[model samples]
Target chain A: MPASAPWSAAVGQGGGVLRSVDIGALELEAGGELPTVTLAFECWGVLNAAGTNAVLIQHALTGSTHVSRGDSEEDGWWEGLVGPGEVIDTDKYFVVAANMLGGCYGTTGPSSIAADGAPYGSRFPLVTIRDSVVAEARLADRLGITSWHAVIGGSMGGARALEWAVTFPERVRRCAVVASCAASTAEQIAFSQAQVLAIRQDPHFAGGDYYDGAAPTSGLGLARRIAHITYRSETEMEQRFGRAAQDGENPLHLGRLRPVVGGSFAGRYQVESYLDHQARKLVSRFDANSYIVITEALMSHDVTRGRGTLTQALTRTEGVQFLVAAVSSDRLYFPSQSQELAAALPGDVKVHNIDSAIGHDGFLTEVGTVGDLLRESFFAQ
Target chain B: MPASAPWSAAVGQGGGVLRSVDIGALELEAGGELPTVTLAFECWGVLNAAGTNAVLIQHALTGSTHVSRGDSEEDGWWEGLVGPGEVIDTDKYFVVAANMLGGCYGTTGPSSIAADGAPYGSRFPLVTIRDSVVAEARLADRLGITSWHAVIGGSMGGARALEWAVTFPERVRRCAVVASCAASTAEQIAFSQAQVLAIRQDPHFAGGDYYDGAAPTSGLGLARRIAHITYRSETEMEQRFGRAAQDGENPLHLGRLRPVVGGSFAGRYQVESYLDHQARKLVSRFDANSYIVITEALMSHDVTRGRGTLTQALTRTEGVQFLVAAVSSDRLYFPSQSQELAAALPGDVKVHNIDSAIGHDGFLTEVGTVGDLLRESFFAQ
Candidate 1:
C-alpha cells in the first residue's frame, strides 16, 4: 500500500467509458472461491498527476454502475450528484462506479457463464459484502488508484463504502455512509429471507436455473413487490393512494370469481396497482437468480464479522473523514441505526438527517439534501 | 330486532357445546349475496334468567370459536382470559365466541360447498369485516340474547368489537377494542396486499381453486411468514435471534446446492427458521383459500366506509362505554390510531396502553395486562 500511485499503466484505458473487465477469481470469506469474476464499471475524468483526485462511488442493491451518463444515452440513477458541475464533479475528479459481484448488470453473477461454460445459476457460490469489496479492490488496483479522495454511497452501497475504508484504511481518504448501518439488523434479515423464499417457492424457479426455459417472472415480481413496499414510507403510500380504487376499477368487487369484463375480478387497490407496476418493471430489466444472490450477500452484511467489535472493526479507519446520514422516517434503516454507526466511529462524526417522508428510498429521491451534505463534508476541501 | 327472544328455537339446542347452525342468506354491503350462511359458535356458562349477562367475544383471523377448554379437551388460545375464574369469568357470565364468516373453522367460507355441490373455492364472494359482524348479529339473535353485557376483541377481533358498538349500539353495553384501529391504515393495507399476492402467485393456487389437487401450501406459508414479521417487534427479533445461524447449520453457507444432512443448502437464519415453523404450522391446520378470503376482508375494514367521517361513524355508539387500548410497540396498528378511535367516541374515552415489547401481538401475549384492564373497566361490573 502506497500513499499515492501516479503515472500508473492502467490510468487512461477507460477515461469515461462504460466497460467490463475480468477481475479474475474472488476468495469468499465463507470458505469458497468464485472461479471467474467479471465487474462492469464506468469511469469519468482523468487520473490526476498525483492520483489523489480519484473518487469511488458504489451502487446499492439492484443498482448498476451507470452513476452518470458520459457516453451512454440513458440517464444514471444518481444523475443529480455525479455530473460535471455536481457535488461529485466528475470533471474535476476521476470518478468510478462498479456493479456489485452478484449483480445482474454486466457483472459476473448467477446469469454469467461458469467454468463449464454454462450459466452458474444456482451453483453460484455465496458472496458477501466483503467479497464484493475485495473484487472491487482488485479493479481499483488495475485502474492505478492508490488512494481515493472520497468513497460515496447510500444503503447497501454505503455498506460497501464503509467496508472500503475499514478493509483498506490508507486507500480511502473519506467515507460517506448514508442511510445504512454498520451491520444488517434482525428485522432487515427477516424481510430479506421472506423475499428470498418468495422466489424459491415459485415452481418455475427450477432451482434458479430457469434460463434454458421460462424465467421465474412471477417469483421475481413478488420479491420486487415485497421490497418496493419496504422502500417507500407507509405515510407516503397512504397520502398518494389513500383508499382509492384503481383507475375506473373498484377493488371492492375483486372477489374470487365474478362475471366481469375480464372474466375475472382482478381489480386492485391503487397502491397494489402501483406495486404491480414496479414489479413488472423490475422483472423486465433484472434477473431473478441475480436478485437472490445479491440479496443474500446483503443479508450477510456485518461490519463486525470476524472483527473484535463494532468499534474495533471501525477502528481501522481511525482518522478518515466520515459523513454519515439517515432518512428521518425510514423504517427499514431507522435514523437510530445511523446514530449508532456514527457513535461507534472513532471520530467526531454526526449523523446528518435527510428529512423526507419517503422512507428508505429518500436517499435516492431526496438527492439535493444528500448532495449538499456531500459538498459540505468532503467536497468543500 | 326484538328486545328479547328467551324461548327462541335456536336457544339451548347446542347448550354450551360447539355447534353449527344455518343463519340463512346475507346481503353484502359491497354487493351480491351469500346464498346461505352457517355460523359455528361455542358457549360457556349460563345465559342467566334475564339473558342480560351474555358476553360476545369475537375471534381474530385464523382464530376459532374455541376460546377456552369447555366442551373440547384442547386448550384455547385465550385460555388465560376466558377461563372460569379469569377476568372474563365464564362461570359468572355467559361467554360466546364465533368463527368469522370467511374463516375455515367450521364456518361457511371458501371451503364450504356451493349449490353445485362443489367447494365455493374461487367463487366465494368478497367479505368485509362489517359483513362478518352482521352475520354474528343473527347468531346472537338465535342465542336468546337481546343485548350483550360486553363485547371483547383484539386485532381483527377488535375491529369486529368496534363494529358491534357502531352497528348496534343498543345491543352492546361495553366495547373493548384492543390492539386495533378504527380503520385499516395504508400501511396495514399495503402489508395485507403483499400477503394476498403471495398466495395468488403460487402455481398450485389454480386461481384459488386447488382443493381438487395439491393445495397452495407454499404460497400460504410465505404469506404467513410475511405477516408474522409484522406481528412481532423488531427489538424482540433482535434480542431473540440477532444474525445467529440455525443449530448445526450456517445460513452463510446456504447456497443453491451443497451436500449436507438437510439435503440442500436452504438452511436459514434462526429468525427465518422460526418463521418457517410458523408457516408450516398454519399450512397444516388452515386453508389457503380461507386465508386469502379473510385477509381481503380484513383489508376492507373501515368503520367509516360509507359513513361521512370518523365522528359520524362513531356518533352511532353514543352513551356506549368504550375501552380502547393499543400495544405500545405495535407496528401494524400504531397507538396513535387507537387514540384517534378513542377521540372520535362521544364520551371521554382514553386509549389505554399495554406496555409490552411483543409488538402487535402484545394484546394476545400480555394476558395479565389485558386481564387487569378488563377487571378495572367492564368485567368488574
Candidate 2:
C-alpha cells in the first residue's frame, strides 16, 4: 500500500483523508459474531522510517475522527490541540484517529450495512472498549506501525486510550487518560440507562431498527438533552442561563389551557431552550442506534472486568508511561475517579487538574490548557 | 365544619383523617381559572385555643398529607419526625399537613373531577407554589387557624414554606426551609424539562389526557428514573450499586442478537435495577399528569419571580424566624444555595447542615438529626 491513500468521499471534513480497511469478522465481548468489521480512520503527518513516531488520538462518544483542520477548512472538535505546530505536532509525529467500532461516522456500526446488504440496526452486537482497542491494533498493523509513541483521549476517548495501554501494553509507549475512569460508576450507568430508555421508548425507535423509518429523532433528541446536562456543570448552567425566560416566550403562558391529544407545552426557561437546541443538533447529525450502541459500550467500561482489582487490571501497563487528568468541575466523570485511576496505576502517577469550569466537556473545550499540558508532559520539544 | 370529617379514603397511608374542603374557585397565577378548588389536608392533635399553636408542615413533591402514622398501622414518609411524642410533638402542637394543589393525593389536580364532571387531565392549569400556598391559607381559614406558629418543609416542600413566608409573611411566625433554594436554578429547570418531555413523549400519554385510557406508565417510569438519580448523590450510588450486575441476568447476553422492532435489552447493572425499582414504585402509586403538573410548579419555584430581587422578595419575612438548612451531600439542592438564601434573610441567619452520606434525600433519611435541629431551634420545650 502507498504511504497515504486517497481520501474517501464518505464523511467528515479535511482533517485527514477518511479511509477504511476491513478488519474481518470477530467474536464480540457479549456473545455473537460480526461477520465483517470495517474500521474507518483518518491520519495526518507521515510515518517515519522507524515507524516509532506514531500517535493514536481517540475520540469521545458521538465524536468523529476529525481532530483538526488538516487539509479541510472545517475545524475539528480539538482544533488547536493537533496539526502543524500544535502540541501533537503533525510536523514531528504521525497522528491517527479512528471512528470507534460502534460509531456512525464512516465506521462499521449499527447504521452500517451488514453482509445481507441491510442496515445492522439492532442486530449489531455489543461492542466493548476492549473490542475497539483490538480492532484499532489491527488497523495499526495494516498501517505498518509497530508501536505508538503515545495514545491520548478524554472522556469516553480517555477510556479507549486507557484500554489501549492495558490491552496492548507493548504497543503503546505512553498513554494519557483525561476526564475518565477505570469503570463506569453506578451514577454513570444510571444516566446512560436513562438515555437508552429514552430512545427505546420513542414511538419511532421501533426497537433499534428504525433506520428505514422516521428515525427516533424525538427519542434521540431527548437522550441528547439528558446527556448534555451531564456533560456540563451545574454552576455553568446556573451562571449562563439562570432562571431567565427564553426571549419573547413566557414559559408561563405558552402552553394550551386544555392541551389536545399529542400536544404539549413549549419550553419556557432559557435553560430548557438551550437543552432543546443541544438535542436538535445531536439528533440531526448522529444516528440513534449508533448512540445507543456507543453509550452501552461506554456503560460497560470497566478496566477491571474479569481482571481482579483495578491494580491487577492495570498491571500489564507497567511499561507504558501514564498521564491521568480530570476536569475540576466535571460531575459526570468526577475528579476523584481520576485520583483512583492514577493511584492504581503501576508508577506513582499524579493526577493532573484541567482547571476548567466546563465540567466533563472541559477535556474537549479547553484546547489551550490541554495542549499546554500535553506539550509539558508528552510532546515536549 | 366538623373538627375532623370522615377519612376521604382517597389516597395516602393513614396519618390524620384525610378531609377535603372546597375552597371555591381559584384564579391561578399563570393566567387560568381553576373552578372549585378542593384542598385536601390531614391534621394531628386538637387545635389549641386562640389557634396560636397550629404548625403547618408542607409535603414535598409526590409526598402526601401523611406526615405521621396517626390513626393507621401504615407508616408515613416522615413518620418518626412528627407524632405524639416526636420533635414537632403532635400532642402539644396541632400539626397539619396539606397535599399541595396540583397533587394527586385527594387534592384538586389533573386527575380530579372538574366542574364539568370529567377528569381535569390536560385542561388543568399550571399551579404555582404561591397558588398552593394561597389554597392552603384558605384551608387554614376554614380550620380557624389565624396564624401558623411555624411552617416547615423540605425539598419542594421547603419551596412552599419559603413562598408562604414571603407571600403571607404575617401568617407564618417561623419558617424552616430545608434542602431547598429561594429559586429553581437553571440546571433544576433543565432536569425538570427532560422529565416533562419524557412523560409527554410516551405514546399512551396522549398529551396528558390519557386518564380515559392506559396510563403513561413507561413515560412516568422513565421520568422517575431521571428524577431519582438527581435525588441521590453520585458517591452514594457508587458506594451502593457500583457496577455489579443484577442477579440471574447477564446484561451482556440478555438482549436479542437480532433485536426485533420495539424490543430492548434488560438492565444488567445493579444501579439500573435500583432505578427501575424506583420507577416501578412511583408508577404504581403516582399519576403521570400529576407528576408533570407538580414538577412544572416546582420548576416555576422562584420566590423572586415578580419581586425585584431575592433579598427584595424575602423582605417581607423580617418578623418571621428563619431556619435555613441544607443536606450536606445534596447535589440537587446545593448547600451554597441554602447559604445564599440565609444570607439574604433579614437577620444574621446561619444555615444548618443535615450531614449525611445519602445525598439530597438526607433531609428525609436523617430524621433524627433533622428533629434535633428543629427541637433546638423552633420546637424547643
Candidate 3:
C-alpha cells in the first residue's frame, strides 16, 4: 500500500484501500429470504476488552460506509470528522459502519453477480428499509456481539435505528436518530422516485444492465444535482456560493461556476460543479443498480408494519433509550419531523441539535455538532 | 367544444377563442433561450368603465386558466370557489386568468412554433417567474389597463403577484400572495429539476422534438406523480388515500388509489395515475419545451436581482402590501421560508395561514380558508 493510504482493513475513507467482505445470502422480511444477498462494512477505532462499546453507524440516501479516510486524498469521505479525536471520536468507540443491503460500495447490490454470474441490475428485487435492517441484524449477530452500545444514523440510517429499536428491541441499547422522520413522507418518496427515474432513464442505463456498456453517468449526475440542493440550506449556499462566479473561466464551458450572461451556449454555475462532484463521486464508488435498490428501500421505510401505527411502533420499543436530533437547516427531513420522531419513540427520548448552515447534509459535513451529540447519546447507552 | 369544457369562450373565461399570442425569447441563467413563446388567456366579467378592477388570477404550477368552468367530467380546478357568489366573487371583479408565459396551455411554450413553424421543443429559452410577470405586463398593456384592483394567486401565481409589485409597483394596487414564499428553496428546485429530467429521459422523447412520436408520456407521468406529492401534504394523502386500496384495482396497477405490493410489474402506484393525469393534461395543452421554459423561469426568480442582496430585494418593495402565507403541512416550501418572506416584506405585508392536511399544495386544495385570507389580504379590493 502507498504511504498516504488509509486503513484498508476497514473502510474506503482517508485514502484507505478496501477489500470486499461478503456476508452472503442474508435472509430478510416476512416474504422469505432473498436467494442471494450480501453486506458491505467498513470499520475504524479499536474494540475494547469488554467488546461492549460498538457503534453501528447507518447511512442516508445515496451514502456509503466511507465515513472519512481512504488510501489517498480521494479516498476519505467524512475523514475530517470521524477519525482520531475528531467529533465522532473513533479513538473511543469501535465504529462499525456498513453499506446497507440495497447499497453499492462492496455490498451485493444490483451490480453484484447473480446466481448466473451476471449483474442483477433491474432484475434485482425491490428491498425495504426493514430488509436493510434485517441484513444488518445478521451482520451484528455474526460479529459475536449480543448487543451494541449504540446504533445510530442520519436520514435513512435514522430510519434503520428506529427499526433497531422496534424490530430488534434488545439488539441496540442506545439509539441516536438524526435528521430523520418516523415515516417516509409522500413528498420525500415522490422526490426519491424522481431521482430513481432520472437514473433509470439515462440511455446509458440500458434498463439497469449496463455492466458491459457505458454507465448512466449523466442521468446519475442530474439526480445527484437535484439531491445535492436538498442536502444544503439556502443560507449556507448563499454564504458559501450564492451566485458567485468563477474567475477567468468560460461560463459556457466546463468548470465555470458563475452566472455569466450572454457568455456562450451553456453557462455553468458553481452549484452545478458542486453537484457534479457529488454525482461523480457517488457513481465512482456506488453502482447505478444499488442507487435504485437503496432508494426503493428507503421509500419503503416504516416502523408501523407489524406494529399498528407510529404509536405502536414506538410502544413496541419499550426499554430502548434513544437520542433524537436534527439539523437546523434540514429541508428533506424537516426538524419538525425529528421532533415528531422524538415524540413517537419510547420514553421521552432526549432530543439533541446539530445547528448547521448545511441542510440534511449537516450530519456529514458539519460533523462537530453531530459528534458532540453522539458523545452525549453514547453515555445514555 | 364539448358542453362540459370549462375552457370555452362561451363560458366567459377569456375574451375570445383562446388566441395564440406570440412571446419573446426568454433568456435563461442555465445557458439557453426558450426561443418560441405562446400564451393562453381568458377574461371573465367585464373590463369595467375605467378598467381598474382587473384581478390577475395567477394559477399555481400545473394549473391553467379554466379555474371555474367544468370543461370535462372532471371538476374545474378551482370550481365552486371563484364564480359569481364564490370567494373570488366574479360578481364584483373583472378577473383576467391567463396561462403564464412558457406554460403548456394554449399559450406559447415548447409545443409552440418557431419562426419556421416547427415546435420550439428543446430550443426553448429559459423563462423566469419575473419574466412571466413581464410577459403578463404586455398583456395588461394590450388591454390598456394602467393598474389592477388586485393581483392574486397561490404558489407560482403568488410568486407573480409579488413580482408585479416590484416590477410594476404603480400598476398593482393590491396583491394577494398565499401559500407561497419569497424565493424557490433549493429543495424546491431540486424537486422541479428531477421532474424535468424524468421527462427528458424517456427514449421516446427524441430530444425536445417528440411532438410527432410517443412523446415520452410515461416519463411525463412519473414527473407529474412526483410533482403531485409536492403539491399536496402527507397528512392529506394519509387521510384521503393512505393504505386504502381502490375498489377493485390492485396496488401495483395504475387504477388503484393506494400503492400495493406485487400488484404490477411496472410498480405503478395509484398515485402514479394521478401524475399521469397531470402530465397528460399538460402534454395535451402544454409542450415539453414549455415545461422546461417555465421551470427554468421559476428557478431563476431571485427578486433581489439588481436590488443588491436579499435584503435589498425587500427594501426595494417598500410600498407593497404583501400577504405571505404557507400551508402548515407544506414540506417542500417550509413555513419558515414564508416567515422569512413576511419579515422581509413587512408593514401592511402580513403572514397568513392555510391550515390543511395538504402539504405545499394546500395553496390550491384548501379553498375556503385560503379564500378568506385572500379577501382579508386585499380588503375585498
Candidate 4:
C-alpha cells in the first residue's frame, strides 16, 4: 500500500513509483552539455522487461512529471487513468511521466544549478517550447527509446507535444494535444505581459535574485489570481461568487452592504477570496523567475515562428497522427484553435470538443471523458 | 480685447465667461452644510439681465465645466463647438457650464477638504449620477434660476441630463442626453471594475490616502491606458499606431519590445507613445482619489435603481421633452443604450447618431456635427 495521501484530481492514479534518473550528459541545442541532470519522473505499471510498451506522459503548466503517486499521497495524479486494466492500462503499458524543462520541479529549471554553481534563476536563458521538446527528446534518447508508443500532454504540455512532433517526429508515433492551441493569441500575450509586470513590480522581487531570501510570492499570487480568473468563465464566476462579500466587513467602509442602502468591505467579494486562495496556492510552490520563464515560453509557443505561415511550420513534422481537442468553454484556447490545427494536419484528422462549463480547466477536471478519448485513440492502434 | 481672456473658445465670439462663486454655509443632501464651497463655471454669454435665457451645459467623463476658453491656451478643449455665435448661439441665449459635484479641478471632489480638514479621498461617500443632478439643481437654485433653457450633456454627463429630466422634469425645459445609455451594461461595469482594481492595487496607493506622499500613479496610468484603448477602435489603433516602436537609446526595452530590428535608436511604436502621452497627461492633471470617486460614480450610474422598471423610471417624471444621442464608435456607452433610453421615453423623443471614428470621445470631438445636432434639438425654442 502506498503511503501517499489521496487527491482525487482526475490525473492522479492511486499507486505509482516516484523516482528520479540521471540521464547521463545531455547536449543542448546551443552546443552546451548539461551534466548530472536528473529527470524526475513517476512511473505506473511494470516495464514488461522489453520496455517496448512505454508511454510518455506530458504535464501542463504548474504540473509535474510526478503524474502519479507521491511520497505520501496514494491518490496520484492521473491515477484513475493509469490503474490496472484502466484506460492507460498500467497492466499493459508502462507509463513514464517526466517533468518538462524550465519547470520548477526536480527538472532543470530556473531554480536548477547553472555551470557557475548558482541557481539559473533570472540568468536562465529564454526557453521555447521547442527547446523543452529538445530536452525531453534527450531524455527519451537516454532511456534507450528510439520510438515511443504514444505521447500526451495538455495545455503547455500540448504545445510541447506539437513541438516534439516537429523536432523529433519519428520518435513520437502518436500525440494528444488537449485544451491547447497552436498559437497563443495576442490577448494571451497581453495578459502574460501583465503577469510579468506584476512579478517584476513586486518590491520583494529584487530582480529575481532574492532566492536566498523572500520570493515574490505576492506578485506571483496576484499573477496566478489574474490567470485563474481567465481560466474560468465569467458566467461561472458570476454565478458561483457573484457580488457576495467574503468577510462581513465592507470594502466601501460603509459597514455592511445594507442592500439597497450601501455596500462595504475591501475584500468583500467572494470571487476575490477565491482568487486569494488560488494566488496563495501558486505562491507556495511556484518560483517567481520560473513563472516568468514558463509564461514567456507559453506565450512564445508559436510554431510558425520564422516559418512564415502556420501551415509551413506544421508541415515540418512528418510523424504520427494527433488527437486535437479543445475545451468547449475555453475562451483562452477556443475550439477554433483546435479546428485550425486539425485543418493544418494531413488526412482529415478529427477535431474533438470537450463540452465543459469549467472553461479552460475542463481538461483537468473531465478526466473520464478525456480518458475515454485516449482509450479510443490508443485502442485503434 | 479682454486681457483676462474670455471663457469663450471662439475667435469671433464668446464661448462664455469662466467664473467662480462661493456658496458658504450651504446645507448638503445627506446632512450638515459645508462651511464654504467654490464652484468654477463657464458661460457662453451674459446670464442676461432677466437670467431667463440661461442654458446649462453638463459635461461628461474626464470633462469639466470648462467647455471653452482658457486664459493662456488658445485651443480650449471644447473649442470645436461652443463659440460666440456658434450653434448654441451665445449671441441669442446665455449658456452656463458648471464643474460637476465630484470632480478634481476647482470643484469639490475626493481631493476636496472635508469637515475634518483632510482630503475626502476614500472617505468621500459614494455618490450617484442622481446625486450629481441633485447637486447641480442646488447650484441652479443658488443661482436663482427657476428653469433652464436646456440641460445638455454627453456620456455620463448625458446620464446626468436624463436624471434632470426625470428627477425634476418640470425643472428642465429641454434635455439633450448624448452618447449615453439608459442603464449601464454588465460588460461596462465589468470593465470598470477591472480598471478600479488596477488603480487600487497600485503599491503606491495607501488606501486612497496618498496625499501625504506619492500617489498611485502607475495604477492610475494603467487605468488610463485601459480607458484610452477602449475609447478608440482596434481598426483605428491599428491604422494609427500598429506595432511600431518608439525611438530611444540603442537598445531600449519596452515590456519586451524595442524599435525596429536595425538595432538603431530609430523609434518606438507610435501607439505606445500615444498611450504614454495619454497616461502622463492624466497623471499630471488628475488626482488618483478623485479618479477613484468619479470612476465609481460613473460605474454606479444605474437608471433602474430605486425606481421601477426602466419605462416606469421615465414615467416618474410628470413632464419633460428629451433628446437622446450616442456616438457611432462608442463601445462603452453603446448606441443601443441610446435606443433603449429613447424607446422607454414617452412621446416622440428624438434620437440622433453622431458619426465619428473617435469612439465615445466623439461626443467631445466631431464638434461641427454635434453642434448641428444640438442646434436641431434645441431649435424648437
Q: What is the C-alpha lDDT of each candidate?
A: 0.84, 0.86, 0.66, 0.67
* Candidate achieving the largest TM-score: 2
What would the per-residue lDDT of candidate 4 be over residues A145-169, giving only the tens digit for each residue? 5566788888877888777876677
Q: Lowest-lDDT window of 10 residues in candidate 1 chain A? A: A256-265
Runs in model 2 with CA error above 4 Å? Answer: A2-15, A254-264, B2-15, B254-264
Tens digit per residue, CA lDDT, model 1, A240-274: 98777788777777443343352123657788778
Model 3 CA lDDT for position A290: 74
**In what order do the candidates fall by DockQ, top score first?**
2, 1, 3, 4
Compared with the true structure, what per-residue lDDT tens digits does model 2 show for residues A89-137?
Answer: 8777888899999899988999999888899887888888888998999
| lDDT accuracy of residue A374 in candidate 4 | 92
DockQ of predicted model 3: 0.23
Candidate 4 chain B least-lDDT 10 residues:
B250-259
Top model number, DockQ: 2
By lDDT, the best candidate is 2
Q: What lDDT tens digits, residue by residue, belong to model 3 across residues B52-139? A: 7677888877778777662334445666666566666666666777888767767777676778878767655556677678778867
lDDT of 4 at B272: 47
Model 4 stretches astray by more than 4 angstroms = A1-100, A111-121, A144-155, A176-179, A241-252, A255-267, A318-320, A325-330, A334-381, B1-13, B16-102, B113-130, B142-203, B225-281, B298-301, B308-381
Worst 10-residue lDDT window, candidate 3 chain B: B251-260
Query: What CAPRI-style quality would you assign to candidate 2?
Result: medium
DockQ values of all predictions: 0.59, 0.63, 0.23, 0.16
